[model samples]
Target: MQEFREILVAITNAHTSKAELAQAITLAADNQAELTFVSIVQPAWFENPLLSRDDFQSFWDEHLLAIAQPAMDAGITVTTRQICGHPFHEVIRLVETEGYDLVVKLAEPSGVFNRRQLTGNDLNLLRRCPCPVWMMQDKDAEQPAQAPVILVALDTSTDTPEQIALNRKLLASADHLALQEKASLHVLHVWDLYGEDRLQGPFINMSREQVNELLKETESTNRDRINTLVTTNGIGDAAQCHLVRGRASHEIQKLAASLKTDLIIMGTAGRTGLAAFVVGNTAENVFAGVDCSILAIKPDGKKHQAVSNETDANK
Candidate 1:
């Protein structure tokens, strides 16, 4: 398991996101980890013009203190602070400054501007944050407390060692979180036999039977890889497995919705050149409309310069 001794949970005061606080607190207590909650506020009355110093400070303390008290009560070392700047910037700054291993924050609740149901800040952090970001779902508020179903999306197609290492870490995270919540685990690998359709033709070409055989072989190879991974990693067979032929983003979303999955644990395969909040990349496409919570894990210490430039342009 990855070491997550120092954790940062962002408490947004725009609305009541108590579920996120509860999640962060439970994780910190169970893991015996240190917790820090930061509520980003307006710089000052004279500076931001949008919010007064007194009002901003009041909301900040009330919001963060509510989360801090519970963590302290649970016997976890807790620290609360109020910072100034945009939500994404402050959180990223804290993660960089304090060396937090994981970032926990509530998914931006739905509103008119939030047609995708996720804030631009959410996408930015998931893209550029140097640590893993857990976007807790607001959907939990609509249902009774229960063990959530966690779906882990695996990309076994990538043959690089770095990609393989990241995939292993992603599965380890999925296993750990599912075990912690006593939730059902779902492992999925999406594959497409590229050029198979184009290869079919007249007299001297491939037939439907040949295509089927190729697909079967590809499926078998993927299934074996998954079996080896789970067995060697101590993951039990009770978890559901899916090897589907479809696009990664669409297939994962369809399965998560059908199963009413509570959280989808995934690794961001995006590199520094990927665009943000778009359908081209897996994480960005998933963030667009998936209702469930998502934990987008990045390879350790990799930065997305594309996202950074976009963020700077926005500022």
Candidate 2:
């Protein structure tokens, strides 16, 4: 949204999809930002231990220079850094130490190519990186279109101050992106009624009309809230709002695909407890399903400590 003065793009030795670099170069070009590409080299215990640090350093310098050639040709200056530690930790350290405005990385594709990708590292960066993280699915994609199609996935059911502020942040960012890219903006809210499964139970004596009426009320109320959100943010007619019914994870993926979204901007409200441990939220689920790029936003105040716990456990 805002002009990114500095950007940090994370790469793993195993995941060398050029799309990530392409996307980063495009962004850097758009913002006139400086770029830093950093990758981590964590040696395994089973590997040779006698390799000198100088050897590793030399290897990375050459590797990164090759990667930088593309950006250099695009008229953007590029630099690279090599770190030896957990990928996420090193990325976070770089962002904090250097004040990077955004982090970019490639999302691991499914099937055979998945083995070399770092799924956990992307999640950690999204959850813990203070700035926004852009996850590119297809590295070969050309620079986003001149008038890119953008979608902002939202959760409009909650009216809490925190959720409201989060919505504002999302809309603001989306609007900025649309203006910057000369893009069309769309707002999507996928809703599922509470206890929807319980309504079909034998114990429930509600008639079909009653059920329809109740569901209608819910849809109306949610529409009102969504409208309020758009109005409050002054999105005006610049963005079209779509309110659909279904599981958010599935619906979001479908909508983004249907819209041919160039970038899906969504927020992740970090969860807690067992559910947090066992699964990802709507944002994560939609991320797994979509093939387009994602710009994930964390709420203004919350820090995802669960990721910290998980990373520590892995260590």
Candidate with the greatest TM-score versus the true structure: 1
Model 2 alpha-carbon miss at residue 103, Å:
0.8
Top-scoring candidate (lDDT): 2
TM-score result, candidate 2: 0.85
Candidate 1: residue pairs that collide:
none
lDDT of all the models against the reference? 0.76, 0.77
| Candidate 1, residue 154: how far the Cα is off, in Å | 0.3
lDDT of 2 at 292: 82
Clashing residue pair totals per candidate (backbone < 3 A)? 0, 1
Candidate 2 residue 101 C-alpha distance from true site, Å: 2.5
Count of backbone collisions in candidate 2 = 1
Model 1 C-alpha lDDT per residue in residues 1-315, reported as the tens digit of each score: 865788898865444466777888878876778998887643333365787878766766776687688889988998878766667877887887789989998866558776665666776777778888888766446644766899999887755777777778888998888887788999999988878767686654888898999888888888888776677678878578888888899999999998888889888844555454453558767766687778989875566663333453224
lDDT of 2 by residue, 73-177 (tens): 988978877776777777777876788988988765446745323266666666667778887874576665556799998888888899888888899999887
